[model samples]
Target: MYEWSETDLMIREAVRGFIDKEIRPNLDALESGEMPPYPIIRTLFAEFGIDTMAADGVEKMLATQRARESGTDSGGAGSGSGSGGGLEGQDSLMAVVISELSGACMGLVSALGVSIGLGATTIMSRGTLAQKERWLPGIVTMEKVAAWAITEPDSGSDAFGGMRTYVRRDGDDYILNGRKTFITNGPHADVLIVYAKLDEGAAAGADGADAVPARRDRKVLTFVLEKGMDGLTQSAPFKKMGLHSSPTGELFFDDVRLGRDRLLGETEEHRGGDGRESAKSSFTAERIGVATMALGIIEECHRLCVDYSRERTLWGQEIGRFQLIQLKLAKMEVARMNVRNMVFNSIERARAGKPLSLAEASAMKLYSSEAATDVAMDAVQLFGGNGYMAEYRVEQLARDAKSLMIYAGSNEIQVTHIAKGLLGR
Candidate 1:
């Protein structure tokens, strides 16, 4: 029953205006991977005062963290250390922006979401004060792009267990060697959050390091890497099935030397959690975000299909009069309503300070992503020959909707999380 407030509606209109002015004209170049999405994203930020707002918010959060670290204000709730509460009041606004952009250019939304939601949020929730001061300001403001690298060539869904990327202690620093593939914004990211296992075998001579865990069983650690660091090579963006504007690529680290300062939280026993826990902590948000993106895809497909059904006439009658076409439209409407309700319910829960559990988020992700994909494919079918062609844009949406099932942990992985949640695992 939750609905967008008047303010939310006003902002949505303004966002739509911005998209029409800024993104629509550049759709070809953006979709062709001919133009990176960052410049337009920055333009959107500046045009809407998002950059200013983000900068102010980050500054305030950092100041609060500083005060708490120095024992000045021991009374407040947040020191910018908790994982769940960075952007408390802006959830609805962010939902509006994400959904709007997703409908027009899902690639753009993916790039932005990985950078801010995964990259900056992870750092903010887990990094030390010095670490935050060093890396966060530019990222939150969209001045610098960030890539969160956890996926690898070998570990499609096994994540930590199959992780081959690893680090070893070297004096007070760590030497990292690994390759990360299918990384969003990896080609041009200014900052990178890399997760690697600690190779205790390399430190067998040290106390308590004699018993090295199996490679797959090693402790996972997170580190921050800057672009152009020693022995670091970022690959060119890959030719992808869809979402070309996001700049997906690979990262190769050949004995990349990382100072202790780069280690998140600067301790293996970070108060926030270890790398596995940190990454898992992001699953709920990431999954819910997939639902948001899915909703947009569903809504866009529903809108296009409805419009097309009314406009295209055959046998001296409108296609809308055909029973088969009507079925498609009805199904699209059902999907839109169901997905929108789920999104609204999530928003209401968030506003009430009751976020969904991982299992619930996973369920939302699974259903919404599948729904979006189904609706998009149906839109293509409803469009007939026009749907297969790129000119109509429905094909592009179909391709984009398919990705929602693959990333943020695949739909297959979502099932396991959902099962775990139900069984109280």
Candidate 2:
């Protein structure tokens, strides 16, 4: 976990080579939001057999689900030696891919993670047999784009309490109404997992609603949706300061209708700790993944800054000779090392089959994001006037890095999570 294994380094080179050939040539278009990252991503997946790997993972999960249902899963008693390690390696490889991609375009990494990591994962972890079979293949293969919609126009930090989106029961069908903003891949997603509470009035009248179990008080539900569904309106991508390759947009559902089959886990009860817990768990993985993304940005910025320092002249000598320039390079190096270690530590913990605490995930996200944003800005400064120009790339990196602080869970929210964990309340 201290350094990339030889195999890991080889994979990095392969990914880097693909990026150079496919992504680098289109950098301008991507930065300008003129091109979506999917075509490039699909090429990457095809070359690396990522889709094959995803297909296999989905098959195994479904098999596991089937076994559990049949009462024949044997409870891991027959799992082969190194199966655990294989899972760990898979996690490590995903981090490597994210790191490499983020270094090139944080937007591409964000889009991929949202579609595969968050969207596909939500369905896999919380879905039933029929649901997994119906949805996971296209998602895993990149044949379909997916968006996990939880944040609404009204809910920013307070997702659950502020969520105004509601689903009203109508016989066996449900009518959904609400708007979601800041949704990744939203503008063009083929599949979506949207979160909403059963309408408050519906909740008050449903069976067991009056008793109001504390756990079910929120009564949030997750529904699988598809494009072209009646009353589902998705806006074009938003013009944001960063993540142009990752299309962010708004969704409006004016009485979009769905049946019970669309319900994740096919249950209205705590199919998985009320829907909020499901979203929170998803955020932990997303938050931790951000640290890896941050490490990539820090690594790239440090490399750029160091190269610029050694080559650029000032006062008749290389800027690297100056104490101030040295200080910036040194700090960037420190951030790179620290974030790298954070990523490796998370990998090692996962290898041991340990789950990161919510607070730990938040801490990792908070520190690494700030560090990345700081390093990118510092890189811009060290490059002088050249850095202000997008041609220099530092400007783009700086802009992209800042968005990390706001996405996933905002740094402010991260602090609140950390403090709540510390206070024992």
Candidate 3:
């Protein structure tokens, strides 16, 4: 229902064309365990500005201007200074780009999402000016791939409570010790945005008590750790049910010493003074990024399912001819529309400088991810046996769709968040 600009339309068409020519034909190879040729993927993203679209440009001209005005950049490793309109416009444009790219390949979309949404945005939101200066260029230029390290072996839905990682401050340096699991792009990441607890004392209490203790508040902080940081190690890519093209792995940080500058936002000692306000601003933008990715996947699943239903036949008629099929397709269409609108509206709200309640962001992720999974499963059903086969794209979509609900935040957690919000908690 959202109106698209002339440039938006043009970009969409161009991205579609590129995917058709370069990515669609290679889906089989990619799904069968071979990574898509990086050159082609890289070229498409570069030409379309998929990776650095948030920044607008490399000279930092627009970003600097926005920073001067809004006190932050366009959702990158800094603040923006521009009017709300500029930020909203960028979000809309980026959403279009994400949907188009994801329509062809979710794995590629995930890569781009991690790099721009999680990687670059972390720095923009929490990185010091020096850290931003050191890291933003390579990210925007696609020279360095980035990954987010938040989930761990025991922490998925309960990320904050389940974190076992600890950081010990020692003079001008901090020693990081922990392990991260199921990290996207972990094996390929040149830079990692890791979250660890600063207060080891808070974790010394009883088991379940420490899990979600109040004192652990100071433990919730982020750090920008890099590859080859001493005691940091990455395991080989783990085979996955879907998104095989994306390299997923575990990360181990054992007493990795980092300079003071590596800490994100403020340290625990200074956190109570200013860190809360800063984290609020940063997380608002980061949630928007995650919501955008979810919207993209949902839109792609809906569009593809609809298209497939219209083409495939059963009992001498197109499957889409059946009333039940029509109903499924209609439901998907409605869900897609709702999610798209929610995403855009959230971005607009964010641009207007409103922080999203945990419920709002979780709602977007929950609804869109569920929609994507439902549509993907229906797409496979509509395709019959062909959908189950790897030869067709539907099977791949179904596989890729599985993770959306689990990542970002589980649907169950999203439900809990919504409940908490309703209870006014």
TM-scores for every predicted model: 0.96, 0.93, 0.84
- Give the higher-lDDT candidate: 2 or 3: 2
Against the reference, the lDDT scores of all candidates come to 0.89, 0.85, 0.70
Estimate the Cα RMSD of every predicted model relative to the unseen true structure.
2.7, 3.7, 4.6
TM-score of 2: 0.93
Per-residue alpha-carbon lDDT of model 3 for 1-425, expressed as tens digits? 34667987888788888888888888777666465435566787677765455345533534564475565444545333222211234666777777776666777767766765667766665555566767777775567788888788986766666677878777878888899999878887888988787755544554775456654465466788888888999888888898877778999998899887777644554433333343434344544555565566666667767778778887898878899888877887787777778776875675687757877777777777777778788878877888898777778778877787876667787798789888998
- Clashes within 3 Å, all models in order: 0, 0, 12
The clash number for model 1 is: 0
Off-target runs (Cα >4 Å) in candidate 2 are 71-73, 77-88, 200-217
Give candidate 1's root-mean-square deviation (CA, Å): 2.7
